[model samples]
Target chain A: MGSPAGTGTGTGLINGMMGRNNIFWHECAVGRGDRQRLLKQKGCVVWITGLSGSGKSTLACTLDHELHSRGKLTYVLDGDNLRHGLNRDLGFSAHDRTENIRRVGEVAKLFADAGLICIASLISPYRRDRDSCRAILPDASFIEVFLNMPLEVCESRDPKGLYKLARAGKIKGFTGIDDPYEPPLNCEIEIKQEEGACPSPSAMAGQVVSYLEEKGFLED
Target chain B: MGSPAGTGTGTGLINGMMGRNNIFWHECAVGRGDRQRLLKQKGCVVWITGLSGSGKSTLACTLDHELHSRGKLTYVLDGDNLRHGLNRDLGFSAHDRTENIRRVGEVAKLFADAGLICIASLISPYRRDRDSCRAILPDASFIEVFLNMPLEVCESRDPKGLYKLARAGKIKGFTGIDDPYEPPLNCEIEIKQEEGACPSPSAMAGQVVSYLEEKGFLED
Candidate 1:
């Protein structure tokens, strides 16, 4: 949601990026703590996994809106949009998909290192792939938000008509059809899109923001 | 250098990244303009190229200091450190080197897109490689700063003793030794190491910030 705004001290930024170059490798410099101090908030990755039409993007965007309104610094790494640029070289094959998540995970870590909340929304389908992302981040820096929705409901939404294509046998290895969607076994947060639990995207966003606030991730 | 501080309008940020999901591909969403306005400054890539020991990193760090003091947003992408992570799969071979620059260019573009002043300091030995980086960016967004330090001077200032290693044949295909270094034919700015032209790192950074200001790249 919202990005926290501040006029950080020189000491803080220097600590954050001093080693970005090789020349200063020998010198002690300011660090992540300074960046966090300057930004008036901590940095973390919010990873959302769901089916194609599970409203993950909408929820991510709405959360970003909520966070920004609260003065939090945030950026969304939508897996789909990343394919248009950073991961453009990757294909949908299983190996390529793993590389895709790997790269996104690394980039998100870089963003967090620089003191920004990175929201990464991906179908992610496999347990091992998600675990790989979790392994690289700092402790408590990764929050998994699992959107649990029935395949039929997601198919009904069919936001991009992808499910229809998959149904027509036009796209093989589709996540919910031929490809399997491995639900998270122990996610940090879980939200159901079923009858009493699911809410509008904005409401769901509020729920996530509440979790962040409750966890003190939003603390100055 | 200084990154501009801001609390941008939700409307603007929403425009810059709303459809990160595949669902909203039919329409444009949040964009660069929103980011620029929020940061209160234009974003551009400052590509610094020179021999390994030509004070490129020093210049970048001092410039970052100057910019941050002035409250401008900036980040430096040093080549050596990138090899430790993002480009870990790459090697010293010519093909890998080219891929390395290509990936850095892509990353710089993404940073600019997010409205951060990106300072990329790399040996980047070839003009064709630099030009390819320029080709991907928007007009006026790529500011090439050629550090015209002579090979002898760079060799004398071997900050990491890498020059000594190259001279002893401990390293192979190094720029300015066995490998060729095609100097830029028409860079936007050129800072020479000669007595009258090259100032202290801080002063040199002043020269750059002045250029940015004169060109209105620093306009609010």
Candidate 2:
């Protein structure tokens, strides 16, 4: 007999069952193309990675506003909001940090598959974890938008005073403080200050929307 | 000074941070109504619950296809597909099952918020877990569809022979065999066999589509 689907023999049985049904299940299922067609736009992940307080969330919200105003479906998976729900069980240990990025990456992939432009705003200092997220989506669909705002600029903004807390040693392992921020070696898009000043939120979102348009993500 | 957003102090800080941002997040963000207007349909979760091998996946696929053909964006959160990625870390323990349902419920809420009709197919055996899932969504948006096919019929179909493995004790704590399945006491929809015969997949999907239409989910 064929391997029983979800025999629940344990974790040992998961591989066999999932592998058996992967191809057949995908064949019978409604596909990403179908969902994209319905939405009239290609689903993609706009992963905004930078140090904490680096305008990642601002860019995400601005991008969400820009896209939604243009009648596109977009959802933001902000790291802060997620900590209250899906990632609540996780802590900020090295292992949990990786797991946190992994779970967020996976969820963003699902949102992309569902035909929404998913904006993921996270510090995501580790390059390996970000690359792993890129590996899950189709080529060009995982648009890694690096917010190249300087740590000095972010610290000065300190819109929520996180930098001050980190400076005071009240918070530890904070990216750009104790933790290292690894810049992406080859991201699809990069947003940085034009001069000594950060670009307006609309201008920042315009850059991404333009990239999405050029890459054919704004259309089915 | 305002509470530092995501100070990384630990889990202790999550509550305070999220509470501060909850109202502001919803206010500045693109609301669900905008997404629904963009998609020309209201977002909602169609959660299908039943025993294993009870055509839950079949109905989910059928509904996905049916909705897609009519130009509605829909996504299925099948228990098996989810187990491979989002819930891979979870096992078959009782606690794991509850966690599984919780995570799926949260993800489904995200999908609905993205303005897609999300169909969640799972052999969720506990009433409390399913009720908790319902509680997380807006009232009347979480439509619980109970597939009331008899366990005998499901065992007879044995599409993947899961019931056979369960019966032979190869899979312990299998729902409707070693374990129990607490059917929904107040599901929004119920599909049961007639004249000792199960309904066709299209018929089952049609029932759900009709309900969605009547409930004004098919249009903004």
Candidate 3:
């Protein structure tokens, strides 16, 4: 018995179902070039990592404000705000931390794809997780900024008393406490919070704007 | 015995221990009026809810484009895009659905509190969930727009083949199929998707702009 006309064996059936079987044909009809042209701007993710109380969220919000003021589309996904929603179910366990960073990385990638600069401020202390995020994004699109405040500095400036609690053994597995913090091996930018000489968040934010401009992501 | 200096059981002791209770003072300093004056605009969340392929996203995006073109600060929290990042782990189950809307609602509230018009597009089918969002936000801040498309019309469009899959039993617990979709009890605006003469998404978007202007949200 012969096979049905539309259901030929193996290769013939595949060809019959797809008709022309030219997967590349649709490339000409749909192009990313139009989206790029419409946006007239490059999109990227600025991943800001630091210890709690190291001014990561402050810097991220300031950068967002500055970028928005300059007519650039920008969004800041902060650690506290994100935890209150997206990462609410996640606990402080090491595995959950990895998952949290993984999820944020994916979301940041989507925002970048949608032609918006996404600023993510998280205390993502694991270098492996950070590396995984960099792997997912395009080269030059993942800007890793390390807020390299000394442990003592962060502890002294414990705005939320988290460091104090960690020290008192109330909070376990806190980064810079019982757990480890693998600082970025080669961060794009590093900000040091000097005692009584720390630059305002706006000043740090200005550095980010300059970086974006130098990288040709923003118009002069 | 009397308590030690700066450790008395009165207002002085309380103020001394909490460092003058900066939280309450900061709350007063950063009141809603202050935020509005600082951002130079009032904040609100314009929530657009409807079934899949019911023009909610189209209308929200159009409104975002229009508001953006006019130099207003706005951002869209689209359902699909958000799921890809912020709410990626959430399934389409009822519990996950509630959590998704709750997260979106909290994020929108934060964005609005920061003095930006937050536009959220979701297939928020449950009236209770929508009501919870309204309760979380301030009065006059939650402007709900219902994309009131009949189920048959939405099914006929089948822009994403979701309705068809639901009907074929390929999809489980689909809203409007095996599940229920409760329309908004008293929505601020309703966009009727009439047969053969549906309003363009841009026109529908313009209606929202008109409402914002009439309500003194946008300068004429």
In terms of DockQ, the best-performing candidate is 2
- Backbone clash pairs for candidate 2 read none
| Candidate 2 Cα errors over 4 Å, as ranges | A1-14, A17-28, B1-14, B17-28
RMSD of each: 7.6, 5.4, 10.1
What are the models' TM-scores?
A: 0.83, 0.90, 0.72
User: How high is the CA lDDT of each candidate model?
Assistant: 0.73, 0.81, 0.69
Q: Considering only chain B, report the TM-score of each candidate against the true chain B.
A: 0.86, 0.89, 0.83
Highest lDDT: give the candidate number: 2
Candidates ranked, most accurate by TM-score first: 2, 1, 3
Candidate 3, residues B134-153, lDDT tens digits: the string is 87787798999998887887
What docking grade does candidate 1 earn? incorrect
TM-score of 3: 0.72
Q: How would you class the docking of model 2?
A: acceptable
lDDT of 2 by residue, A1-220 (tens): 0113554331133344432332113223677887787778999999999876688877888999999988888998877667666776888889988998998998998999888899998889999999999988877889999999999988988766777877887777778998899999999888898868788888989999999999899999
Which predicted model would earn the best TM-score? 2
Model 3 Cα lDDT, one tens digit per residue, A123-169: 88989999999987777989999988888888988876767867887
